[model samples]
Target: MTRPRRRVKLARIVNERKRKAALKRRKKALIKSLNTICVLCGAEACMVICDRTNNQGTHNKMVWPSKEQAEAMMSRFKSLPQEQREKKAVSNEMFLQSLLAKKSKKLESLRAKNNQMEMEEILHNFAIDPTSIEPATGKLTRLFLYINDLIAKIEENESMSQSATNVNLV
Candidate 1:
C-alpha cells in the first residue's frame, strides 16, 4: 500500500546553508517532474530557471531540454499578444493561491456530499432490513426526506414519459 504523504509546512529555513541546499534539492525534483510529464504526455515544453543565488555569476540560468529548443519555444511565446501572455503567466505565489482555492472548493463540495453518501449507505442498510440500523431521529428524518425527494423525481419523470407516449400515440 502507498504510504500517506507527510505534509511539508511551507516555511523559510532560517539557516542560509540549509535553505540553499533545500532549494537545490527541490529545484532538481521540480525539473524531474517537468521532464517526466513532458515525456509521458508527449508535450513540447520549455522551462527556464534563473538562479541569482548561484556562487558563479557566469552561468545563472538553466534552460531545458536544449538552449536552441528553449529559445525557439520562447520566441513563439513572445509572439503571442500581451493579454494572452499576461493571462497565461502566473507568479509562484499566485499559483499556490489558486491551487489552494481549488482544493478548498473541492473540500467544501466533498463535505457537502458526505451527508448524501451517508444517507445512501443508510438506505442500503434499510433495504436489507428496516431495523438493521438505528440512526438518530434527526438523521432518520433527513434520510426519509432524501428518499421522498428521489421518489418524487422518479414519479415526475414517469408521468412525463407517459404523457409523451400518449401524445405520440394520438
Candidate 2:
C-alpha cells in the first residue's frame, strides 16, 4: 500500500538554512514539472503564458522566449550547415517580404478610404444646398434669420451709395 503523503509545515521550520534548502528543492521540482522550455526553438529559458487548444489535443502552455534566449537561438541557427542555413535565410527573407507587402497593402487601402471620404465631403459641399438637405432646427432658423438681417443691411448700404452717386451726377 502507498504511504500517506506527509504535509510540509513550512511555517514551523525554524532553521533558516533548512528552510532555504527546502524552498530551493521545491522551486526546482515545480520548474521541472512545469517544463519551462520553449517548444518552438527548444530554449530552456522561457516564460509560460497560457494554455491553448488545437485540433490535435490539449498541449502545454505557450513559452515566450526572452531577448537573450532568442538571440542565442538565432546564433545557433546561423551556425548550421551551409545549405540549411541558406534555405532558412531565403525562407525568412520571403516571410519578411510578404509581411511588408501586406502592411503596404493595408496602408494603401486606408489612404484610399481617407481620400474617398475627403472627395465625398468636397463634392457634398459644392453639389448640395445645406438648407435643402434637411429641415432647419430652431437654432438653425435663428442663424438663418440673423444672416438675412445682415444681408438686408448690406443691400441698404449699396442702394444708399448708388442714390448718393446719382445725386452728385445730376
**TM-score, per-candidate, Cα-based:** 0.50, 0.26
Model 2 lDDT, residue 134, Cα? 42
Residue 33 displacement (Å), model 1: 1.2
CA lDDT, every model vs. true structure: 0.87, 0.65
- Lowest summed lDDT over 10 consecutive residues: which window, candidate 2? 131-140
Report the C-alpha lDDT of model 1 over 26-140, residue by residue, as the tens digit: 8889889999999999988978887655565565877878899998988998999999989968999999999999999999999869977999998888889998766656768
For residue 82, model 1's alpha carbon misses the true position, in angstroms, by 7.8
Best-fitting candidate, scored by TM-score = 1
Clashes of each: 0, 0
lDDT for each residue of candidate 2 in 57-138, tens digit (9 for 90 to 100): 8754534345566567668876988888687455777989999999999999999778556545544653676544344435
Please state the error at residue 31 of candidate 2 in Å: 12
What global local distance difference test value does model 2 have?
Answer: 0.65
